[model samples]
Target: MTNFKPGEVTTTHIHSDILNRNITLSVYLPEDYSDLYKSKVVFCFDGRDFLRFGQIHRVYERLRREKAVERVIIVGFHYESVEKRRIEFHPQGEKASQTVQAVAREIMPWIDQTFPTYKVGNARVLLGDSLAGSIALLTTLSYPRVMSQVGLLSPHYDHVVESLFQRCQFKDDLTIWHVIGKEEKDFKLPTSGERADFLTPNRTLNRLISATSATYFYEELDGGHNWKTWKKELPALLKYFLSNQ
Candidate 1:
């Protein structure tokens, strides 16, 4: 077992001209990070929630200290409101594509210049939960040259499953770590009170991607669609993706 200690987290602002708002980012760097070394990075959506609920900094520190995973810088993108998250994280929302572009075009380049990053797409990860996971998938598909890997924790795949499958049929050198709870079969959407069955479509997506040439991992665990499950699985996912790199 690893002793989970908190890492150094700093706050910074990245200007997104497309959204016309300065998005706040919480950057977590390993204790040993320095200008002499370049590290991998994970860009996380729903930033504030992840920091508070996910306890990702502690997980990262434990993994890094134990050598269970490679050193990484986790960047948490903070959202102003639930409505704002819906617009930016939803697959078909008006600002959805623009949000992806902002991360790829604006945020990434800035991170590279500001920090000692690997500066390669394969060394970076796009991570998010629920609808944000949907956006992360879309962004990875759209900008594979910028972000080649994605961590989808209970992605809301109802609306985007078919289209994503169609895209996955083609050979894209992408790596994905996807997990959904068995109990997440039905849940009420936070934005709309409509009930959504996430499990079935997520299973469909797993099968589709498994058939494809891309590298993928799918886990259907016994839990619900909440941060508790995600937080519990975070260390394992980080170790899987960031380990021995």
Candidate 2:
């Protein structure tokens, strides 16, 4: 097995004209990194939350050791604040278009320049959860040639279903992995009169995937919207994506 340490974590800031602010980005490099060779890259939204809550570095290390996935570089794009995060990551407003542009023009370019990455279609994967998942789906659809693989964990779908499908057409070249909890049907939120009736929307998304020429995988796990579920699902997700490599 390939033993790995925690690896290096670095932070940088980018000036975004679209959002009229600077965004901080966190990058996690695998322990077995080599600049001489290019590695597959996974771009994830909500960098700070993922780093703290998801423990992705630890998970990546374990998966690498097990040889389930190839060596990968993780790029986490952190939003400015909670308020800004919601506005930027949410796929329901005019600002959402700006946010996507910021990622494609500013964030992705910087990472491609800084790291030795495959810089191709399928080798680059986009990932997110909740609102970020919506953004990931939007971005991948908008830029299919750049991002061919999308990982969505428990996406939040209230009423954006039609717009999502209208904007992007699924092709055979794309690969998508979507998962939600079996108990997430009509799940309620504590703070407000909000709820995630994810079962129907997810099923709809799965049906769309089925109609498309894309390779798709859908699963219903035994948990709710939490890191435990995501962590448990990460290994198999990575294996599925990396198997094509």
Candidate 3:
């Protein structure tokens, strides 16, 4: 943490016409960021948690110092609250579709136009965990061309998700990295107090994505659904994203 050359971190609030709200974003540009060439842009949801609970920033800095993966830009989408996260990221949320569109139509374009990037979907990554992961998957499905690269960590599943996969078409150029905990078979919902089988649906989703022509990787580990479990997987996930491209 001390020896690595730290990246520049900046925060901003951008007004989105689609969501009709000021969306908060934080960007991490590696020490090697250059204007002469493009860099892969990783757009992460659950911005605040990934930095705090997930320790992605620390992990990323270490990765860069080790030269494990090539330098890339990381962007985090900050949610105001848990309810706000669900309203936009949940599969059944009213604004789910709009949130997906906003990432593809609004945020990505801004990132590309403002920075030296590939200016296409393949050069971008959508990464999130749980509900945030669910929206990442839906966003990729909704706009395959603009969001071809994705990382979904234990995506919270529902019939709506399964139905979307059943109805949508999968393109060949997509790359995906999805993971779930083997012990996450059943857990009590924090909000609804209902029993849910996260493992089964994640398996179903694996089969669904595996059946497509996507360049995909799926894993089931001996862990549960929490930041402790996810933080350890950050290196692998980021490597997977950088490896495929």
TM-score of each: 0.92, 0.90, 0.91
Residue 29 miss distance in model 3 (angstroms): 1.0
For each candidate, C-alpha RMSD in Å?
A: 4.3, 3.9, 3.7
Whole-model lDDT values for every prediction:
0.83, 0.78, 0.83
What is the per-residue lDDT of model 1 for residues 80-166, given as tens digits with 9 covering 90 to 100? 888888888888778988988898889999889877889877899888999888888888887787788999999877556457547
Query: Mind giving the per-residue lDDT tens digits that candidate 3 earns over 75-148?
Result: 89998787888898999998898898898888988788777888777788889898999998888888887788
Q: Per-residue lDDT of 1-245 in model 2, one digit per residue for the tens?
A: 21223387777777788778888777888888878878898888877777788877678888788777886888888877667767777777658888878887877787788877887779988888877888888888777888889898987664564465555654666898999887778767542558867767777777777887788899988988777778788777777887535
State the lDDT at 142 in candidate 3. 86
Higher-scoring candidate on TM-score, 1 or 2 = 1
Q: Which stretches of candidate 3 lie over 4 Å from their true place?
A: 1-6, 190-194
Score residue 37 of candidate 1 by CA lDDT: 80
